[model samples]
Target: MGRPILGLRSTLKSLTRRDIKSYMSRRYSAESVFITATGNVNHTKLVRALSDSIGKIKRSGKAQVIKAPVATRSVKLVKRDLEQVHLCMGVPVPSMTDRKRFELYLINTMLGSGMSSKLFQEVREKRGLAYSVYSYLNLCKDAGSLVVYAGTSKESFGEVLTVVLNEFEKLATELTIEQLNHTKDQLKGGIVLALETTDARMMKIAKDEIYFGKSMPIKSLIKEIDRVKLEDVRKSIENYLSPDNITLAAIGGGMKKRDLPSVLK
Candidate 1:
């Protein structure tokens, strides 16, 4: 629940059989589990099968409550003689359930979801500063963040960071109505295309239930995306994209923590 959502290998190796048993006993129960199914299936037979199997699991007294995670701002640099420097920089954003959720998605898309996005267009295509650059949102139950990642030569890392930060700062005001509409189309198209498969549909349904308590219809989702105005994206940027809230992690050769870009300082 900290910086690393996945436990470290060292800690995983230290876990004993008793630790696993204790964790399962404390966290695994009918109350804490959710079962979701999609595609062509008989509901009655499904219910019967579930009752005979998963329903038999003993019910715990109550669900284990997870403490919400907090985002921290820090810079870390790891030295290694790798071929390229890799960096992940991000800032805290609203939770998945926030009203500006769609706007956040649009912001992410406008920044770097595709080759046409600002970061890819500026950092890789036009400037040729980096080979790979993209941005994505990592949202959870009560907290979230927008992260930008890039891989480049060690000598180009500073220019790449500067270009990424410049694009980030421009999001508050420079985002145009045309760009917003194009981003909406991109996101909507992707969402519809993803629903073409059973596995994708199943995952979407599960995620919707987990995050919003009910599965939202595709039309409704598209409508939400369409409803996001340029002002909404600007407002989201103002609320969440503060430089002071940024965190940076870079792994490469010869870079020190003190060598972080001035924008991050």
Candidate 2:
């Protein structure tokens, strides 16, 4: 109840119909809801039907006070008997609305999206340290982070983490013109490919509206991705990927927090 906002299994099991209804009554409101659609749809008819159904619900008038999530740098080591150790290293980054997010996407693609990525090439192709290694961006409305995940033997866990951390440190200055262009192309291709389906298009529409309060055309987004210069990427890395913003977490046997090298910065 103190920190677990979603509550645990025991707390969930204690919920009754009345409790759920009460919570919903306080949280669900017309002002907080959004409806979006894609494909052949009659907008007027859809709105009419929705108004007849959803309009009946009253507004709760509970002013939503959203706060940005705080990112604290620390290492969390969870002990467990397993064949391999799993780790997730993360650093704070700007929210989705930030202009730098596009560059961050390019950075993520360059760092871990494919076999050609730096992490895959160094960790799996060259050193044989991990079977799975990748980095991704997790951005919400007001806060976000870039996270890397890898799994390896306990003996190799420290080495893998060190390699990943070194990559993070090198990213600000080590990016090349060729790498930047290639990563830009990769990111653009992925974005275009993901919008081929109706559902994907629908989700994109919803997100664009939610984040920007307007519909952003794919061409505009592609153009923005294209406009991201090398300097922009380096600036974003300098701003967000510093040592003080990084957090490392691991789950495995034998490895403890003390065993981790103080290599972050």
Candidate 3:
């Protein structure tokens, strides 16, 4: 696959973000074929042309990256229905080239990563507020996101938002070295434990190569984890732990626009 895919380049990479999205929107007009076939796509027309060119490379020159058009989601809740939202709040972080992917990782983990995380212990355990919660660090080819989420009863929606924001402020302010270290250890342990399987190792290597442009050695990766300092975690939290970077995508009971400030106060 690499040999066949080696010479490919994104013609759309040179275009402005708006132009590229517009081109993708027009090309794939109603089809999703182009983006899936080629991992790096730029337009709808390109997708159509690629689909038409499949098994006929000479007829199409070279295969291109898939870039689905930038447009609104196909399915949107009605304004009234939006009262129950699924907030997908996130902040952009270091480029894949920065080699500090782990920093973004720890931030995600310490925030609301699991049943034991800050958000869960405070919001879920103490208050028994939400039905479910999760934290995720979505690292992409060039960029990434750190997000926290929860689904709660509409009646407690305002307080849920409040708890989330207050927790965010605490993470930025009151986080102690011990708290940070525990998070780092958990983060490192999770990765190492995941690598216990051969298939997992192969998949991780493949993903590393695809997203980070190189297959990182497990040993060096572990060493990097061990080297993470208190300052490192703090720096990541300081830059990313902000409400402004959030993009709330809510879908569920009893939240209103007016309740947005449960945390601001």
Candidate 4:
């Protein structure tokens, strides 16, 4: 919430209780100062659109109110005392525009993407090393990171963690050209779909400007990702992925720090 969505219309900003005093004095009250715009708007459409829908649902003269929890990064957490843990890891990434940034991303997707990925195929589908395993990329202002996550039973957690580390090290040294290219194609496919509509274009422009201060053409960005070489990806894995730099947010009854340090190695 440090920076709000830019697509929101300024009028939709509600009056505080203090500002309500001024609102009552003015002809254009808070209710009247509502609008809709195209760029960056999503839930922000509440002012122009949703208020009516919400009003219709409240058919009676009485009112009911419900409040949702605040923003949270954790999507799901349960306490079953299951003999396993789920771990989320993130690393530092390069700039958004850098073609090489996608190198790590491609590797991650291929290594963890569903039935076709190395992690899912080896860990979950084949050997039952884990119930869930995957990899992803997160990009921010000047840096981003490749991340991998897994849910493993406590008995298998340490062993599966070692297997994950082996997979990472293998990418740096013995990964095949075919596997690397497949991941690159996966990255390309993902980037292409991102600009599927005018709304997407506008959102990209707004977010890019907010993050990088300059808007990169979608085509140009795609070309950069397409140009990446295997060597670039290898360097990213070796240089960026490390035991000391890795941060794992883990949840489970069986989680133990003693068994985790070597995976980032």
**What are the per-model numbers of colliding residue pairs?**
0, 0, 24, 3
Per-residue alpha-carbon lDDT of candidate 2 for residues 1-265, written as tens digits (9 for 90 to 100): 0147888899899999999888788778777677889899999999999999998888888746668757788878899999889999888888999888898898888888888988999999999999999989888778888989999998887788788878777888788889899888888899999999999999988898878888999999999999999998998878777767778888989886555768642
Residue 243 miss distance in model 2 (angstroms): 2.4
* lDDT for each candidate structure: 0.85, 0.85, 0.65, 0.65
Worst 10 residues of 3 by lDDT: 69-78
Better of 1 and 3 by TM-score: 1
Question: Using alpha carbons, what is the TM-score of model 1?
Answer: 0.93
All candidates' TM-scores?
Answer: 0.93, 0.91, 0.68, 0.63
- Candidate 3: residue 129 lDDT (0-100): 83
Q: State which candidate has the highest TM-score.
A: 1
lDDT of 4 by residue, 70-187 (tens): 3222222334576678776655556565666567567677677657888788778878888779888776555566778998887676677677777777768887788777777777
* lDDT at position 129, candidate 2: 97
Model 3 agreement with the true structure over 147-202: per-residue lDDT tens digits: 67777766776677778878887887787878777877798788889888767766
Error of 3 at 184 (Å): 2.3
Question: Looking at model 2, which ten-residue stretch has the lowest summed lDDT?
Answer: 256-265
